[model samples]
Target: MTRKKNSGDFLKECMADALFILLRTKSIEEITVSEITALANVSRITYYRNFTSKEKVIEFKLDKLISQWIHEHPRKESASAYESSLSFFQFFYSIHDIVQTLIRANLSVMLLNRLILKFHDFNTPDRNEYYRQIFISFGLCGIILTWMDNGMKESPEQMAETVSRRFFPQPEP
Candidate 1:
């Protein structure tokens, strides 16, 4: 009997689990498509049908998560700039594990760089939002890396509050 094709979600989940396993054991440079397919217990054909490369898998996962968060918890039309910043940080914290894993895999920095560019395009300003977004993204990534290196001592909520305070300093009432 012919085996059924895995749904898109199922393939993505397999890829994610494979990534975690690969990140735990090997450097990103050493990982191959065959390894991912083997780890995921799916055929090479299946993996090729889903993603072009391992890097694409990581990028796809991050993009999907970011898009989903933006769709699900959109900032209020009347929300202040500070509120919007806080909301984003909160959403990032909610996905801290995946973030941490990606960081550990050395993909977080690359992903953050892409996000910085995207954020820049979204907010057109004379002051160079591109530079600002790059600075903020790198800063947050650094903070998370340090926290994880130290064993994630604080809760995500606590980290989010601290980041919000630093990035979106309270404005005068």
Candidate 2:
């Protein structure tokens, strides 16, 4: 199916595009609701109704984008565990823009913090889980940045294979 230039998705793309445009020229703190609304051609009423702050836009969009990416390219449940695990890199290819936006806003840390909170098993993060999330978050961010920095020269399939070979070596047989 094709995405069109009307309806809810269109409006979201417009708002996100506007935000990205504004983001390129100014820090999120310096950018205003009015500026985003004006650039988006979306009314202030709508913007305020959907977003409470500029950071909220990044939070909302990045979360939605990553979730959508994962849903669209989900790991095949029946695949071998190793193949399913490699499916993770497929997600990075799909979220380039949103990831870059988070980095540009200096909000990748916030995104990592949010992910840790979301994945916690209980009210409090156990020391083990906390450190696990911290390690994974930093490691994943490094992978994403390095991939981008290298201009995404490797295809997602290549990245997945490289990651599996480099990080998930098979047990000696």
Candidate 3:
């Protein structure tokens, strides 16, 4: 027999969908927990149990998307930072709607900061690896935030190439 579905995940998805639906009609500041729970058909207690705040609902979704993308499109072990970064931007661009909403809610920076923590590899003995992750997160996040803010006129490939050149330039021989 198949295992039962995890009701917790289902509730979270309901809440997330409710939140996103509200966001389309109202800014994050205008939304309240009451509205989310009411729309999601879940109690306020369930919301609090799964998410600390409304912002968390969005962060949870974004974190999952990013992790899934990274996992599915594994970077080559020998790939340079530029290649890795381009791959990331490509995937991020594919989900521009979510990122756009996060920016509109003014929670993009906070999400990125928290996600940097989530993705940190504590098992590594190398301190530089930790620092490298932080550096990459901030740098890449800065570029993407700017692009999103400035109307995102450039195509994903263009944005990736431009950012890669500025931030992850080729090393001189």
Candidate 4:
């Protein structure tokens, strides 16, 4: 027996597929909600119910990816700064393709700024912590953009190692 499809799930799948197609063919600025709905074979109402705007859809995808990363790499009880950096780099590497597309679409800078602010809000408890978080997030965005601009030649692991050395230098044993 075949299971019935849920309306919400169906709409999400349609949106995902449509976004993938859009990424390949056209700039985000050139795409419209009607076009997305047409490609997804869904009504405009369904699309509106699911997402307020195309940008929201992209935000939702990024948020989901970040949540998955947090789940996959929970902060250890004794997690050091390097471990935290590595965990984030791993997550970034996993979603590199989607990220590259966002970068190509000129959305990465805005997204990165928002993400850094979010991280600062979440991790910073006091004034000092706030500054530290802001600094780290800002620096991380620079490193990530550099990697993307350089065609991502090195593996994420190698990039993480470089970041670790630069930001969280190891002490001589």
Candidates' lDDT values, in order?
A: 0.72, 0.68, 0.79, 0.75
Give the higher-lDDT candidate: 2 or 4.
Answer: 4
Judge candidate 2 against the unseen true structure and give its global Cα lDDT, from 0 to 1. 0.68
* Sort by TM-score, top down from the best: 4, 3, 1, 2
Report the C-alpha lDDT of model 4 over 44-163, residue by residue, as the tens digit. Answer: 998888898788777766666666666777768787666777777777777788778877877787558557644546554588877787787878987887787678888877887888
The 10 consecutive residues of candidate 4 with the worst lDDT sum are 1-10
Candidate 1 error regions (>4 Å) = 1-6, 80-86, 117-127
Residue 142 CA error for candidate 4 (Å)?
2.2
Q: Candidate 4: how many backbone clashes?
A: 0
Tens-digit per-residue lDDT, 59-118, candidate 3 = 777777767876888768798766776787777678777777778777678667755766
Residue-level lDDT tens digits of model 1 in 40-155? 98988988888887777877777777777778876587875456656765676677777777777767776675565444464656457657766777776677667766767776
Question: Which of candidates 1 and 3 is the stronger one according to lDDT?
Answer: 3
lDDT of the structure predicted as candidate 3: 0.79
TM-scores, all models, native as reference: 0.73, 0.73, 0.79, 0.83
Runs of candidate 2 with Cα error greater than 4 angstroms are: 1-13, 74-86, 114-130
3 or 4, greater by TM-score: 4
